[model samples]
Target: MPSRWIATFDEPALVAQALTALADLGVPGTRLVSPAPYRAVHLTGQPGPWRAMGWLVLGGGLCGLATAIALEVGTSLAHPMHVGGQPVIAWVQFGVIMFEMTMLGAGLTNFLAMIVLGAWSRRQVAKAARDGLRSDRLTLAIPTSGRSPEQLQAIRAALVGATGIEEAP
Candidate 1:
């Protein structure tokens, strides 16, 4: 089983240093718990939800456009309505429906994505709170399981100047 070690740091710089040292040691899945956002310890190269949400919204709009096209064309073809020598399926008249449907689809998709992302972030925050997160200090949770004694010692040495260090129960 993997054991977790929690290290509390009074300063963001110390937390940042510890994170860099852990990365140098090739430690994976290290989590930083902080009450407020810290630019020093921000991890890069992670994909955010906005990209996925944009793709989803685009897909929804396309589906809406397809639906509008089918509705207008299918209905016109089913009951051919030729008014004032105009075409049975007029693209100009269908523009309003297509635009409205596309906007509606994109808006609804964006709204749902926001809800899901908000809930997911809330769950993560709750979990962090359970893991010794505090409002006045920063915490780093390092997994020491499957590590050799030398590696464990190196991890401890890296975090030597932290405010406090202990194993998670």
Candidate 2:
């Protein structure tokens, strides 16, 4: 038996209907591939890692800010260059370094988070592309590896009007 089933549909309505039907069948790992985003199809799943990413970025920025403060204050105190009645540690001048470090930290954290979180979707989209998915059509990939014969038959019945049905690679 194939590991997965692929169904292609030209009409958005059919794809939407097929998605709902698959959901009703309790099919897991059902993915939709479309040339453009469709308003009709709603994806309901766990919230993405974006919230965690935001927190991570905030932490990274705070760490960077702390590092910058330490560097500026420590170096100033250690060197102790009292220039023309100015204080040993100048808080106003440290703003540039603090801002730069904070931005650097947040940007790096954001990049790493994006790479890690986006990998799975990237692989799925690449698989869809390799399967001859077209820009003018919508494709649905349904995992069928653990499904019983009857369940497979029911899935096929649900997608009766699909333009094409094939075993996904």
Cα lDDT listed for each candidate: 0.77, 0.78
In the range 1-169, model 1's lDDT, one tens digit per residue, is: 4477878888887888888888888887677777787964475223446568888899888888888999999999999988999899899989999999998888888889888975775453325324676787888778788889899999998885688877763
lDDT of predicted model 2 = 0.78
Give TM per candidate: 0.61, 0.71
RMSD of 2: 3.5
lDDT of 2 by residue, 40-100 (tens): 3365232455668889889888888888999999999889998878788878778899999
| Candidates' RMSD to native | 4.5, 3.5
Q: How does residue 17 of candidate 2 score in lDDT?
A: 83
Model 2 off-target regions past 4 Å?
Answer: 11-14, 34-51, 83-85, 120-134
